[model samples]
Target: MIIARLRSIGKWIVQKQLAEVVVGLFVIVASLFIFPGADLGNLGLQMVGFLVLVVIRLYPGFSVVLPLFASGLWYTGMADHTLLSGVLAYIAIEFAVARGCIIIAVILAIEWLVFGYVVSRDFNPQVEDLPGVLFEFLCFGGAFIIGQLR
Candidate 1:
């Protein structure tokens, strides 16, 4: 019975084209091992974000609110230790674009910028930080373009 249930779940994932969501969830769990010193509090928040991402992927109607929730998580310093929050924001952005809601995408992008600024405010940010920051922006831009292409 359990095996049958697992197979049904697997079938549902394939039917829904939810491989990306599964991968995202895997990465979230992997981060716990990758970063041994990660705060449990932040991990909890990331888990919440991951679950929301899954929900949004399954039901795009939830897309509008995820960016706001992710922004709040970032603003409160609950998502600062990892890139999962950015992934959540980008996924929300992609969903908004898919639905032809450019306004939501723009709002998400602006919120992302605010999150970035808030997270980076404490640091002096030496020259070495430039590459990482640029890469981060590139990822955001790539997400937008990918959504447009789809």
Candidate 2:
């Protein structure tokens, strides 16, 4: 019975495209290792945001609101977890492409806005944050374009 349950769980993961979920969790773990001083509460919030992105895979129609919700959680609770946002953005854009909808534009706009807000919140923009911000935007755009091609 236990083996049967394990097999069923594996099937569910395959059907749900949950490899992204596994990668997200790994990113979280790696973040913990990289930032040993990270706050537990902030990491917890990041985990929640990651899980919400996974939910988006299950309910593609919720793509609109879920990304916003996850961004809010990440920005307000833990702006340091930028990798989580990258993963979230990739998954959202892929979902939009899979659904063959123009919502991809909306998702891209939302991700850009969230990224800007987070970067501005964490850095002094009037000084020298432009290049870094532009690079980050390019990274996001690359993820979106790759999603489209996929």
Candidate 3:
């Protein structure tokens, strides 16, 4: 029964939003490769969380909360430690305009600073990895633009 249910769900997702589902999965895999030091268990948990968000994303009315959830995940270090910030940014900017993109970037940056330093108490993680942070930002920015276009 469970297997059949899962299969049906998979079929529905493929039929309705195959590209999105694939991209979501791709983000998970890419994050694993991108952030080698990230905890596997946390990544698994986050993947499950992402799936839930994706489900909400596909829901007509609940789609409004996706960016909120994604940004929340980003701040809490559950958004793949910002290594896959591009994916979250992409999701947030999927249907946004120019002003929305700026808002997303500002909000994401603020959360990254607050949670990464104050909440997680991980001081200076990016201080020495400035280049990496910049690269990730570039990817996130590019993905945001591409998502908006698509």
User: How far is 134's C-alpha from truth in model 2 (Å)?
Assistant: 1.5
List residue ranges in candidate 2 displaced over 4 A: 1-15, 61-84, 101-105, 108-112, 115-127
Q: Which stretches of candidate 1 lie over 4 Å from their true place?
A: 1-17, 55-80, 119-133
Better of 1 and 3 by lDDT: 1
Counted clashes in each candidate structure:
0, 0, 0
Candidate 3 lDDT (Cα, whole model)? 0.52
Q: What TM-score number comes out for model 2?
A: 0.62
lDDT of 3 by residue, 94-124 (tens): 4232224445444554444444444444433
Query: lDDT tens digits, residues 87-110, model 2?
Result: 545554554554455465456556
lDDT at 39 for candidate 2? 76
What's the alpha carbon RMSD for model 1? 5.9
Off by over 4 Å in 3: 1-17, 29-40, 48-106, 109-121
Model 1, 69-143: lDDT tens per residue?
Answer: 655665576666654666766765665565566776676677566555544354344666667678768877887
Alpha carbon deviation, residue 104, candidate 2 (Å) = 5.1
lDDT of 1 at 123: 30
- Deviation in Å, model 3, residue 51 alpha carbon: 4.5
